[model samples]
Target: MNTWCVAAPLCLSVQSYADGNLTLENKGEDGKGKCPFDPFQRYASVMFENKLYSATSMNFLGSEPVLMRSSPVSIRTEFKSSWLNEPNFVSMAHMSESVMSASGDDDKVYLFFSETAVECDCYNKLLVSRVARVCKGDVGGQRTLQKKWTSFLKARIDCPVLESQLPYIIQDTYRWCDPQQPWKDCLFFAVFTPQSDTSDLSAVCVYLVSDISKVFAEGKYKTPVPVETSFVKWVMYSGDVPFPRPGACIDNSARKAGITQTLDLPDRTLQFIKDKPLMDHAIQPIGEAPLLVRRGAKFTRIIVNQVQAADGEKYHVMFIGTEEGTMLKAVNYNGEMFIIEEVQLFQPPHPIKILKFSNVTRQLYAGSDYGAAQIPLATCGRSSSCMDCVLARDPYCGWDTVGGKCIVISNSQRELIQSVKEGDASLCPGADPVKPVNQSIWLGGNVKLSCPSASNLGKTTWEQDSSPLTLSTHLQLLQDGLLIFNASHSDTGVYRCLSVERSKAGEYTTTLAEYHVSIPEGGDDRNVISPEAQINGPSLAGLQVVVGLLLVSLLALLAWNFYKGHLPLPWNYRKKNREQSQETPDQEGLNSCTTYQDAQRPALAEDKPLVSGIDNGSRNNNHTRGAAAFSAAEENDDSTFTPPSLQYIDDESEM
Candidate 1:
């Protein structure tokens, strides 16, 4: 355990715990401190032979990076830009390769990180992921490069990056050693991402331990030189190399020449290594490319587990964690990457900070800022049927015919059905029946039928009543499901979503979703235009219905006002009546008017027909007189109306 003062961020105290008690490790009896290493930077460390090997900064400011060994014999790399240039340490692993070495070599510790490139010429700084190695037997030099690693060498990882050519920064690494296999045959897996902020592309790459060793032993060295009017260039050195190799570990061949330890070596050898620690050749992945490259994901951490399947072949299953708090279970089959499944690890997602796996417990533990999660290595029970279990291509899971369930594969069980390469589930007892979802959609309504896709490699196709579903203006296929713009009677049928995947064996089809759609004979008289349609634009039928309803409403309002005696007569009829009344009337005309008024007034109380006839005759006379007066006024005016002609022009000059 350690304690730090909040007020003084630089003041740190280290302690050790044993027998339920804590003892200070860096405090002296005289009330002073003796700590040699800083623990605040993003660093990597490993324990080998009761000693700590770490790649960390030397001071509190973290400007000077170093790879060091602690305790009994304190040793580290020289403070040089060529050796370690602003390196951000990622992870470390201690591999015991001495057991299988015929040259009596010592085990080595490997460091994975990204640092400013020393071999590149650019206007701006270029970062590159590197794999550096140091022998456990390296003590230090005597004269030239004392108290520094003699076997230190680093090389760039040659895996492909994003299309934008962004640097693939190494985030985390895991060393996978196959059980009962030699250390040289083991593999090192690293997770890489292109710029933590700008790019979401991430990749998982596997490098054989043997391949990394080859580059350090046989690859050429890179020397930095200044060019004319340009940045310094790092070119391959084609000169004579020193005897016994510069960066090679002190093996039996060196002991034969009376030089074993790095301290006994001549200053010339140490000087060559210190000046040029970089290799010219880059280390390629297992397939000369990344095993998996995901465009929309950022892989934070990864752990690998090699399992023996029922087919008697061992395969590597990788459990990778992403920045979105999701875990992806993926495996490579026949050089093709297959993502088995993805599961959410945290709610209100946060980036995964740590990932660890225990072979004894067979559980994977993941940690984030908010909380931690424990997941099983194999989720066989989640695969409900034989076809699903087999098609999953998971080396850890198999379908048991007798038990009728998917179970974790074991050497003891031989009857389990699994196909890791071919993905042929034909050996199963029977096929799982497809359960169709019943859907009742109203006529002229929109519907969205969903088809869940399991893997990105699979292709989805739609079928209606065993015939291919053709896409039209009303029907469209989406990434995750199918959409119907406006359903009709012809759209009612059995729809199925089938997913097809190609493999080495052949193509396999699986039903992802099924729907039984039906429309009743006589449906409710509901509005045909849905809210979605209204947002898009109204149809012709909908517009016509709206116009008809508006016309009926206007007529009803007028009739209601007239019945209540609130409606008035037309202004033209009223004005014409007043003008005629103001004019002089002959005796005969006045007599006729008086006689008509007397007849209508007496019969209005008992005879409705006679009163209506008199009122209609008077209205017809007023309409005829108004038309004649308007015609006479137009004839008297000089600015009278004329029909338009092709040759007519408003301006006489233009004409």
Candidate 2:
């Protein structure tokens, strides 16, 4: 309904990322032989009659394109027919009832292909598009058309641009049916590009199953007649056709006798196909123009599904595959077409050659040059956040506020839809914060930091300390949002992943994942960090180093103070002048100040004499004293020696 809306992702990221829902595994193998056109152009593959069949080239540009069949138990069957000369097939289908006669001997498999005419070689090489049918029970004709289709008949498919009347060549075709509707109403949608490559115009023509059958019933046959002096002239031949149609699958009516065979058929019924190959009437698209008219990329394959919404209304959802490995989903709503979304399905740019859909699983399988891959038709759960769920205009998914997740809608989706339409975000309390992930690595080593986003619809950039990094070999930002390459301590910083998202509202930027990287100084633990460390956050080796250094400095400070003995007490004295004044000086005298014992600080006390009550002789270098023997105040003997100022001693004694 709206231009491709920008929605939030399950987890906010530069490229919207989540648990990848699309599971891809290589299926079959790389195609060996190319189609009749080119090895690069893959052939048409289809599931017919409960068996897998593909019409592929013998080799790259080799002779007749062979129709190959493979089953679970049987070896591959390569049905070679000389009739299919340089035939480039467009599509295949299993004929519904009524497409065949009552003979009950013809095949239900039908093919639409374009080939050069053998009979009209004299006139010119006419590129004819025809519908061919094969037999189901006929292994090989015993006498006639052995190993070839006996009931093979084809008619022309008329497709032209209505406005310019430019003849468009069929490039791709798809057969679509709705189980809930009548099978007879099914139609074949063929994509066409003008024969002139210079023209940028493309078209889609819808051909009815019944209209194609009319060409076999009563249509003119192109017959060439030789003139006496001129080239052969082409004319429409009119004649009574044979009973069992050449291309019709046999039922159980007049053909029940089982006598009618390709050899038994006369020229009248065979000529029916020749005259009717060119149907002048044109088949048009559902709307005014083609279902889609894109400019650059061509639509390679398409498949349609009837999706029933909650209201019991069914809509035909079309999935169109392009040459750019993109799958575009569209819906025919209210007589208008709306493109729902476009997704990049293939890992490489390979044009989609075949498209198949499963109604049971709602999954689409695309075949290309590389291989076949399956993708879910709906990506509802990819809208995890409430804002994303509301913005993602998907019919099959919605936000489950109670469950705190985006879920595929089945029963409890009505409320989600109503809330989103009403812009009610009350259910979502708040968005979860993107916690900064921590990591530790050694210098000269390498580490990878991934910035996985929920959706891949944004531009990602790596910023260190909020500044863009000029990434080099030493620090690299990979295409997939991985920060890797050689690492060093300088690389450690607050690395953030910023994703830029644009919407009709405007451009919005957000942080995806913040990496707090730390590198250990020493090269001792040379290996990478542990897995547990990754989950619990980066190692605290850097923080531990800082704490260790602080503890060592504290211990050294305590030991240095004990050496000077200044730390025991900020103020200390071995001689107390007050106590010395009370007691007479015994035969021994007191010792001098021991403040300058530490070589770290100059001996300022040496400039002044000792201030003790008993000023005994010059201070002996051998003077020794313990704390238990001295008790005196410097104030008690100020006259004995000019004592250092008490104020100065107080400041100097302060350790």
Candidate 3:
């Protein structure tokens, strides 16, 4: 092992901004120290025993990757082995810790990285990924590796290939840490993509902490022959190795106290680690296929979170980031990967290159070169209504009855999962149910029907007239329950958002929304309102009838009062029928054929009178002429009375 001095962060200037609880830290000035090493571009950092352990690299494309401890206090120590300087570190974790106890189990940091090497002469120079361990207390051997690592040992991380003996390339890794199983059971999942263009496939593999330890303990190794040719000179070892594994951490009860350092140890243990670093077996993914794969959208980083729901059960939640700035929240369900949601964390092309999750605070930190953002892991406040909370189906958040709000489930909630699934909504009493929306669009225009459902377990669907909707050339149904496309008259219907869930009681469907989508018959571009600015429905027909009658009564009363200028209504209100009889001269003016139509003074004459025989006798010569003159005059002007002059004419005719 060779020693290399590490640069400090004193020269590194930090630029930061604080908004509420979120703090964004951006790299300011160059931080290289007098040691002539560049500042780290990225790091695989972890918290162990209240301290941060990081496998960091500077000018990663150029050189110099080292392991360091920071935070709580900066720059506690730095270790730079000769083998480590060229490696590209990808992931790091605290393997074991023993600061609390004096019995001395071990405190170790495990780092995973890839390096280019011509190892053992068995294989030509090639790039390989490895898992390296170092004792936390190791200062170095006095002579061989001063200020360098003594317990430094690395092994190949063999990712098995389907058709080739060569290992697949390790692209990324995520740690699955369980607080319930501290030292015994921690595991890692690695993403491996094949080098073959024909296959062009990737897979996720799981490696147990116990399995990794066993490989270093009992596996055989390859060592170079002493007088070997340059090529193909390495063979399996046949000699006795050192006592107590060389990779194990140096501790009080570990070796004889007199030895004190790695220099006095036998050669077998050190060479064994060097020869055989690859694990004996390769761990496969949970399912038949990889966790996820796509021809486009390369994955950038993955972090695993364990969730303890109200039901006192746990879940594995994976937040995977992509190069396109999309973060997919997924879950492992019965060996299948279910993408619950996809959130665009930033503007396109601004990828979230780094992600850190705090289990204690339930917060997620996402960072890019420009800035870092912090958001809560559980968005309890986002569930504004009870229906929204239930639909979200988030295990960490539930409706709090006493607070009348959606809040993170407290420790006392043992049946949080069960409570949410009952669908009673009694947990959030008095909250208004979500209302269905009515939408109207113009013919040949665009229409988007949104049906919101929060539960990931439910299968969301759209139905028209109780029949399932099918995607047509122009009509599309999206996973988020949005039915959108060009609107037409044929699209007028009641669209229902139905969620079907399969349970022990068989399949049940719940209708989330009933959208009445209508195309306006009024048909004009000017009449078309943007979705955001659409007007409300017209007033009720009953209200219009009441208003019309009130306006009519008002006008009729005004006309009556206008006719009687001298007379006034009671309390100055218009009085009804206050006019006297009309004057004879004014009556004569209106007596002509037009106005005399209402004058029916001779109306009695038209009846079959008691004097029906008198008219027959009028045929006699005495009064026939006079009576006939008068009757003729009456017939011509039946609306007015005949004058006395007509009577005299009748007397003269009789004489």
Candidate 4:
């Protein structure tokens, strides 16, 4: 069995931009210190010119009530107001939201607040709130210090009734004006009817003033000019009139008793009595403080459920912040309203107090309990295909099936393509629109490109310009066709399959299919070490044999020299010196044999052992012995030999 081990190059992909957690501090307010009022209590509204205005209402122990206003971005206070009359201000309820309208001679901002009478008996009774108008002309100098405020021509409607009993009482108000027609200004508010003591029956109400001439008329303040009001109901829950219901009613029985002239039913005034029981669905509550956009006479509702504030320039786009920590977006095309998208703009559980849109950059800003946030309008929208539509830059012209000509998809689709041509002439050229794959594939692999089937048989051709090669095949008419390539370098380019059909009448038709093929650059196989570079196991064993042979040869040479007695020069000289020293004593003792013979003293007492007479045979034996001894001495002398005693001495020294 063969196994292959592969090692691929490592590559680390880098992010296009840095990614980390971002903590942005609150713009103006330091979180460490205590603010005079709850920062969340302030609400923001945007004007047509893109300036942001915030409103705050606080009730102090002082006699006068205080109203505060400032620019959205500035920390410095801009405008302040005290109560008109000095009465111990009981509970002061500032409108949670404000609206800006320009229906009158001057641009006016309508502020809504609820007030209660300071006296004991009236203390428990909640005063109905009214819209207070502040004209643009009245504001002058830096920060517009000189201020004038006027109550709405209508009496203050009971807030509880406006909140619950009356369907038309605005629960929330949004500021809006039409740029094209400034005079046709309008305010949108959410209306709700009180069903139970706790729940609100919701709807949307719009107040519109078509003409401003009456409001601009020259007059002094005798009685406040009553601006004509009209109400439009949207999203009603049941059968309910959009009007305020008051808790008290004065008795007009004296007129009926003939004590005074008969009076009309309070002429242009609506009153409600608490004694009267409410019938089922008696109140029609509209949207609370609804943000509105006026397109001609049609009023577009910009907010949905729980929207605290909304600001929009064109009816086509709107930015709405809800009390549920959510920022919702809706777009109006023609007369239809569609919620495009929504983003969780605030942290969970923090209610969004205000939402303002910038006219300069068209960005939307939201204020919540924590801080403020801004989101680009382009980041939001309805269509998931919008990104692709923008990249195509095709103007998103709707397809014309009948006329075969592409036309813009206006409000009406059919009307746009009426005069365009039809059939195959209108089909998009080139390959089918490319779509992202489920997963990226490795290089040098076959990929299938799908195209719609043709009614007739046609020729399919695949070409890669980088490879300078083309593969063509005749395909039977099929819904989906597949082209194959035995992996080749030339097949790496963008592969396209064109199906061409030639009719018998000489008409040629073609449809295109495209696929992208990539072949990574590098050697296909890995380089491996050659066997020649590795040591052989058998060669190591052979080296051991050669070493053994060399050792044996050296040992034999040493043994041969010892056996021959041809020891080194140092061993030879030591043996010779020992022999000479031993021989000196031996030579002195043995010299008497030669001297006795010369002196003829053989017959002396100690030496006279033998008789004179001897047989010839015995004498011959003696002479033989003497001759042998003499011959051994002469051989030794001629050979330069050491004496026997010297030889014994050398042997002992050697041992």
Candidate 5:
């Protein structure tokens, strides 16, 4: 139901809808059947003074790339391989150069992109990050270039980390400038990735506008030369340079020489620029190296913000977006890049497509294919402890002693403690007491003590009784805890897990966990000691009463048995023994005359075997009995012997 306009590439076509109806429609540029911009290929565009300037492919197949002005109708870059070779445009910046230019040069529009490197020789294709500039006042030449730009020139943006590690693929770039200063003092920050997939390193490099201008204006040009039968190579041209330079803008110096425009330039100058548009000197970064180099993340977008800390020193904080929908906040402290923290901006992690920072709101706007998110630049209230807040070293957060919490620092704030560089927790007014958990374990048993890591940058270690824990066969350190195998009494002590984070200022130690480990005594190896049983002891009077009751029951049973005449008393048993000894051998049979005293005698180790020889001797040496006894002894010698019993009483009178 809303009115809309579609700007297509076919003759700068426009389709307007008003009141749910198509009111106007047109096609092609210059009112002719010619396409000025390709609708299929991705492109980069910028608006300057109500005029649209775009760098995009001109054809459907995206083979022919060009940088064209929309209002001028087909005024674009010349279709030459030297100008742009398979360039994939990323973004564009349009700023005035009148503030710092001494030559009174025209304003310029800079384009950032990655294209196939024609100057480098390799087995496969090599793409390099480039920054190309074109004067805003360029209106094409009269006869030489016709409708093509005469000031179009590009140079490599150098972001070298080491001699061999070169991140040449530019993923994204952002232009940052101080609001109180002129636009000429702006700096361009670019995110570069390595061309090879062997390393996933991403680097952020900053380029000064002056360095880029010098390379285009004063650098040498590379010219093509024949090498072999059909091979040609582009090398640096070391010959007499043409006047006014090939890629210099039409400035006051050109006006003094009676050449006020590109049309006034001779045919020699246009032909020279057509063959050599690439600069020999690459634009190095501010420090001749990358501002930050991270190995595990591939940065997709970046935004920089200038912040004033509590110390009154200004720092530029860079928020870099990764391919995994995470934002990394980093800053260069004393020439060293330190990553403050990483925030996950999306769930189920989509790649971050765009990033925009608002200086007024102090918020970061991130967008992806799924949706967009608005995240605050700092979340200071998440820190629960002063030590944690201080060790974070976040410039936006400070420990508020009066409020007993961490709060955000602003220009108008006061009476807050912050040490962004040192991360010294000693500056804190007071620290929370560390309470140790008491654990009672059995001897010769295994136990694992847990410890949490305070920070990802810190190293965890176990300390015993205020000294470094020594490793032995029984002690083992794990990722999150310590294991004691077959724990002994020697392993019992106070254990503290300390996390130490090292920085340039100093090292900070924080106690993650404290434990008081003790092994209870008086326990067998097979049984665990019971705490309840150890707390309660047995009563001595109870044991004595139970023993007396058992003794009385035995005496009453013995008396009842004697009264019933089933069991003989001690005197009766002695009288029976005497009567048995007084009886003659003829009065009783051999087996019936045996006494109970002989049967009750205990056996001894050295006792001899019982035989019929004693009975034979008692029978007055009878010949028949003696002959039978001799035969029995001979038969018993082949069989097993039964030894006689020998009993010895300690006190015969008591028995």
Candidate 6:
């Protein structure tokens, strides 16, 4: 027996290994300790600079956003809080999707959230949407009280509104790296508005904010900024517009009467609206604000628009998740939009508060009402085929276009064949067959080849040339990994059983077992013997000749009988009668006498009794005689019966 082994490819990895099994790595559970206030609501955690940072409020009721930083390995270690009150509102309530970005000399941890006032009264009038900044150094400390977070700057304007009739609010905030300006920071935030008049008019608006620091330093806050900022609108659909309901809640009475108008708008914007210099102290009118998204439209609700790298030159991609559970992905290319992919991450109508991206591993993590989920950006990077991207294992790596290389991030086991065996014989290196078997067997005979029985070991195939043999009809796979081939010339070949294994050093080892098969010459000729040759063999020739002569004599006698018409009784009777008529006058006169008697009997029956008792008795006797005669005739007929001689001939011919 000869042995062969084939190794499995090393591209496979155990993304997640547990209890002697492996699975692809998916989103993990929240690691923070359970809070008594709200056990259902858990804060999101991220690993940055080897430290785990978690964002939470001081109390469940408080809106102050605070960060707790600690080593990921030590969960109980002290966590430091970072943030300070700013010129504007400094309240934070469960900060949505926080991410860190380093620009120039400053490393900024950008926190995206829709600013909310704890007081319901203030919340209704003032909705602050902001991107908070924290330096990298603040998160490195281990003390909670020592760490201080400061609000660097806030958006100059509020979220846009539509018609002032519908209830519109900022739903969630998503931060992504700008594709066009990869080196510079870009943010995409989604605003969700509810439709008051129609259910279909709800909408989501996406605003692209770039170089947030410039917006703060330029005093855009003092300007009368456009209520409808440079934002893209996704509207909710209503079957019809010009809403029919005109109730106070459905009507724009307060806004139309200028009840909530003010001059505390952005400086640049107030100059344009009022045509004169105005004091920054005056409050701006909410009705004058532009609508980000139309109310009651189809695609309404908070949703992630695009998650991408800050610098467009990098291959960084981001995915944004909305309150409605829809995910949108965007790629940055030299100041232009490259690609935008959308995925539904959650069931519809649920709220989502935050969306963040991890720069180190390029995984997009989302936070919503149901829970949090992380999707690898590389998995969604496929251009034409989605399978190749989604099936990728490594989170840190991506598909390289130039080198045609797929980067591997994690170290895991690769599948390998363990061993090959034949019955009790091991086909591996040590315990194989003592002799090289090159035996040949005729077609329709069983040929057995065995391999070791192991889970990792895959099935083996018998190849004639390079093609696999048809194993269904002519081949059987035994439970012991023995390949049994039924008799067939196609089984003639150098059959090989190959096994492959991956070593701890990441190299593949192969072993092979081979056997040479040929058709036995004598066996073929023995099975193909002709019928004539068998009959003419030395022991039977005399007997066959004797039987043949006897058959010929019988056939000649039958043919003579048929030619003489002796085999047909009717023809023979007619000939006999013709011979007698010409030769015997007494026989001819007897025939005439019988014919005359038959004609005289019919005339005598007409004179028989019509009412005599003796005649009736005679009639009954005649009826009995007639029944007997019919029975005898029926018994004499043989049409339904088969003769033994004909059955015997049929049986002999069939044999």
Per-model TM-score, in order, reads 0.69, 0.49, 0.57, 0.32, 0.69, 0.30
Task: Report the C-alpha lDDT of model 4 over 1-655, residue by residue, as the tens digit.
Answer: 9995633222232334436644443334321111123332322233423433323333222322333233332321122221222211111112211234221123444444333321112324333333333332222222222221121221232223333442223335454444444434433333222324354233334444332212322111111122344322112123232122111111224234332211222211222111111111111112223323221111111332111111212232454555556655554333334344456776664666556567787567777658888876543122122221121112223334455444334322363211111112223333245442231122333345566543223455444543323334422223474544334454445644454543222333443555565544342323432223333656556778999999999999888987787666677789977876766644634443344334543333332233233233443244443344445655563433232221221222222
Q: What would the TM-score be for candidate 6 when compared with the true structure?
A: 0.30
Error of 4 at 140 (Å): 16
lDDT per residue for candidate 6 within 1-655, as digits (tens), equals: 9895632212233487789988854544433331213444434345556555555444444344444544432222122111222112212222122233321123444444443322123324344444444434332212321122221223323444544453444444444444455434454444444424344343333333433434432322222232365422222222221111110011133234442222111233222212211112211212333223332223322323232221112343434444466655443333333223456676654544556556687566766656777776544224211112212211323333333333322311232111111111121123233243585665555666654432132234445444555657556766554455556666677665544323222323223345677776764665654333455566367778999999999999888988897686677789977787785665565555445445644554343222222223344344443334334434554423221121221222222
* Full ranking by lDDT: 1, 5, 3, 2, 6, 4
What is the TM-score of candidate 2?
A: 0.49
Off by over 4 Å in 6: 1-46, 60-104, 116-125, 138-147, 150-157, 165-168, 178-180, 194-211, 220-655
Q: In candidate 5, which residue pairs get closer than 3 Å at backbone N, Cα or C atoms, i.e. clash?
A: 10-28, 11-28, 11-29
- Whichever of 5 and 6 has more lDDT, that candidate is 5
Question: 368-390 in candidate 1: lDDT tens per residue?
Answer: 98999999988888777777788
**Between candidates 3 and 6, which one is better according to lDDT?**
3
Better of 3 and 4 by TM-score: 3
Q: What tens digits encode model 2's per-residue C-alpha lDDT throughout 413-488? A: 4455413223233434567777998887665666888886634445788898889978786776686666556666
Looking at model 3, residue 410 earns an lDDT score of: 61
Q: What is the lDDT of residue 654 in candidate 1?
A: 26
Write down the TM-score for model 1.
Answer: 0.69
> Tens-digit lDDT track for model 3 on 1-655?
9996754444333355456454435544443321124444445666677765666554324455666554432331233332553666677777765645354546777777776643533345456667766666664444444344556666677666456455566667877767667664677877665544555544456677766655554655545555644353445556675665665665555555555555554456554443443333333434333555544455667777877767667767777776677776665544545554566677746667788888688788887656677766666676666644654556667776555667777643433422433433434445444476788777667767877754555688888867888779667877666655666777778788887765332455567788887766675465554443334544445568889999999888787776775546464453322232344654554444333333433442332121222334553343343344445554664455543331222433322
